[model samples]
Structures are given as C-alpha cells and as structure tokens.
Target: MGSMAFSKGDRVVWNTPQGRTEGTVVERRTSDFQLDGQKFTASEEEPAYVVESASSSKRAAHKESTLTRRS
Candidate 1:
C-alpha cells in the first residue's frame, strides 16, 4: 500500500521567491498545478503545493521540493 503522508489540509512550508511560507494543501490533482497568482506551474517535475501563510490568510503555490513537513 502507498503511504498517504500528505493529503489535503496538511500544513507545510515551501520556499518562494520571497522566502519560505506556511500554507495548507487545498486540492490534489493527477497533474500538479498552481492555483491563482504566481507564474510557476505545479507538477511532479515541479510538484505543486498550495499553502496559506500563517501570518496572513493569503495562499500560494509552491514546488514540492521547496516545501517541508511541519508539525
């Protein structure tokens, strides 16, 4: 069986052009993708992670490589 380590609602940290920000996984797609704003797209090649900043409710997409699991 595959491990469902990260699913929707999971809190994670991802590196952005500005810096690392915290957010939540909003959706899961067969192909990774980014939501609104930002130019970068999300995919396994550049797996996308939807995160909402802890400081602000603002959300953004980030590459999985840039994201880290948070407790």
Candidate 2:
C-alpha cells in the first residue's frame, strides 16, 4: 500500500454505512489496542482512525478505507 497522506489534526471526511461524516484526525494507529497508552485495537489491514466531527465536536473511530482527507 502507499503511505496514506494523513496526520493528527488534519481535517477529513469519511463514508460510514450511515453517511459521510467530516472531522479532524485525532489519531493514527497500527495493529494494536494501545495508542498513546490507551487501548484501541485496530489492524493495518483494517487500521483504526480517530476523528472529531467538524460540526458537532463528537469523536469516533473507524477504518482507513472509510476515510479521506478533506479538500
């Protein structure tokens, strides 16, 4: 795979099963449950991404393929 152009604090958009949601990158993780000492299990094949909503300030974690950098 290519080096995904994403980092913490980056504004982004993603497609969930429900709909598209916009947010900022709150985290990037490998195949582990512990990120920055907190437990968050996600794999590289299905890595977990943490984001905070642009409108609501709510946060959520999701898969990489579901996310895209905001233009």
lDDT of each: 0.64, 0.76
TM-score of 2: 0.69
lDDT of 1: 0.64
The candidate maximizing TM-score is 2
**lDDT by residue for model 2 (1-71), tens:** 44664679888898767788899999877676643456767775667888888878877776676778788
Measure candidate 1: CA RMSD: 3.7
Clashing pairs in 2: 33-40
What is candidate 1's lDDT per residue for 1-71, written digit by digit as tens? Answer: 12323578888877767886777876544464436744655454444556678878887665555667788
Cα-based lDDT at residue 20, candidate 2: 84
Candidate 2 Cα misplacement greater than 4 A, ranges? 31-40
